[model samples]
Target: MTTSAPEPVAHGVGRVRVPMPPGTGLPFSNAYLIDDGDGRVHVVDPGSPTAEARAVLEAAIGDTEVGSIVITHLHADHAGGAAALRARTGAPVLLHERERDALGRIAIGVVPPDLEAWGVPEDRRPELLAAAVVPTAPAATLADQVVEGALGDAQLLDIPGRRVRVIGTPGHTDGHLCLHDEEADLLFTGDHILPTVNSGLGLGGPTDTNPIADYLASLDRAAELDTGTLRALPGHEDPFTGVRERCAALAAHHLRRTEEVAASSGATVWEVASTLTWTGGWDALAGFTLLSALRQTAQHRELVSRRRGL
Candidate 1:
């Protein structure tokens, strides 16, 4: 991975790509340091739970104080380092209020899906269940990570000089958010949108609303931004512009997948997922990959069924 020095995006906004732990299947996740127009800096998505990751973020913060820690979502690769940083700086941790509530209800670990219900073959069930050993929260998540505080939609952060407003975009997770800085024309999108990868949906655990539906609406909210000039600093990958076109492309991709799900109306999620496209082909999916594929297919299937009133 190319080591990046803290690169300035705007006058006080800088992007640091924190390397993810090996085996995460990705290169790195980004952590942004936004000068609150005061002496302190506000950190966004501090990245992996690894000490090396925290060190990278700490180096970016240097001697400057950390005013607040804002997480885009609770995913480890995104918010994992929050606890350590918060402890070090005594800075309050901020996330969507819904995510704060989720922390209270956070399960001890991820519960394995019902293999029979998803129609996984009996032989495949054991391997999939084994992968369920993963935790629902970051391994380093601490009790202090609890309160500290939270974020709200349309709320402007207490950055004295910058006009950073929170835009609630709840698709990737129930409380996923993107920060829009009208003053800087920059969007700190936390997995809400990416330049290349199609981020998986419904990762934030069970919710009453359809994650697919929530995601589409969330995309619409982001599309309303001044995309012509707004540069998006995504949770992963390099920073990029063309927010509007990228939004449309992401929407179209999901819509196409939805259409594919609709066409195979009567199929089980496992069957439907097999017919639809996957990065490595259906036959190659196993364990957690297979589980994720089926769950996503189920979400699309549910969306289609809901629309049909079936």
Candidate 2:
């Protein structure tokens, strides 16, 4: 439940659904507060970068000391308010070492998708390229959000009475993570396995390994947890049970997508993406939407090729 005062989300976690920029296709981001039972609270996923969003968080924090700022990933919505919060409270922001490295890469700017390589028609190229510069969240600037510490796989938080372990579940991004509270049986799954939507793969910078393969393995790894009782608190949606079922469903969806890509007739990424199903039909995709679709199609095709050893 969304609340200004600290409310129990599970055994020790409190939640605040921080707002996002308009037309972002998402209404709010879940900012979890884990109290250390020692007057300090650890903040996770600080939500969109805005003075309004920061006001909400600062009010929720209310007189309590900030123990640390932990980021699950490097998305603007999740890591946006981090800079301001750290500037205000001097809380050392902690992220996975992989994610920290990714931030360094992002600050230098990432390469845009090769439209010609994807075989996009010359007419559609300008619009797609122009959309790249329009800021989706003008208030949420990511270039300034820096990391002061690195979190490793299975690394425990320094809270005296908690046993929260950071699980490196890289799929949605190159350095995505999920926090598993062994004592409380709660997993703070940050876009790794959402209750409502299937997160895209390899949205981060260029990776040497195949994203589909990495995502599939990550799904299996998350399924290893106790699915019957462990509740997941996602970055967007509300908390839920049935971890195993959710993991299986996500995996099946990806596998089926790979099979569809394998069967589709196409000599290029654009051609195959056109034949695939989209929420508003393939012709409706443009700009960032089109870019994302082509990238995902390319990843699926790579997965099929790897499995066949081609």
Candidate 3:
């Protein structure tokens, strides 16, 4: 369900909640519109591809020149509308270099083959395979198009009123980025640190590093940014303070699971996952949900193994 229209967060910042299609997991994802003091705008994480969402974003943009479409990551709920928005506004879309390549591969039907290796039983394999189907751009012409430019770590964007620096935080996805508004003491954490959800790790494109390890290191990086009182404007939840506490909590949450998976060594990913705790219990998860559980469990096990020299 979409919430109210875009509301101001700061002098030049506003947040809009774009409703996802029913049963998409989240109630609504957020997109941010930033004014450059001039008439130009920089849109962040234009969520979803629905007409309704487009309408909401359009209303928020009003008559401003769209300077750039900046994507925090390439997840469907975050970057699904990039191509469409770019087409309409003629604004260049910017993404992390790794995510650009990952999205391109996804558009061409190159997906991960880790499912079979997870040792899921044959009876449940179909559901997992179905879950792995990622939606690409609406048109074949836009399918291979991800972004027009790349945002590197620590690079400052040329937005109007804000000195926004891109911070590379890989874990949720390799090349995941968070934008820091130093002037405002605000950090735009894109699914890297949420208020409520312990968002699944390694859920993005394939990565060469261990996702759990990367996630922990990313948390540390986030902690260092907490000027003791920095506020965080996350992708899914409302704006929050205590950035250090939130970052520590997210890290501890995963490390606890790492301990659980560590104890279940020598078991297959599916078997180990079946023994761990889930939101609705292990047996209740199926299809993509179950596959996600298994994959994260596998990632945790690998992280533990690497640490212990197993």
Predicted structure with the largest TM-score when compared to the true one: 1
Best by lDDT: 1
Whole-model lDDT per candidate: 0.82, 0.81, 0.79
lDDT of 2 by residue, 117-200 (tens): 989899988987775433222212443545456889989988768998988888777888899989899989988989978887
Candidate 1 error regions (>4 Å): 1-5, 108-111, 132-135, 139-143
Q: How high is each candidate's TM-score?
A: 0.93, 0.92, 0.92
For each of the candidates, give the backbone clash count: 0, 0, 0
**lDDT string, candidate 1, 29-81, tens digits:** 98999987678889999888898998888887887888888889888888889
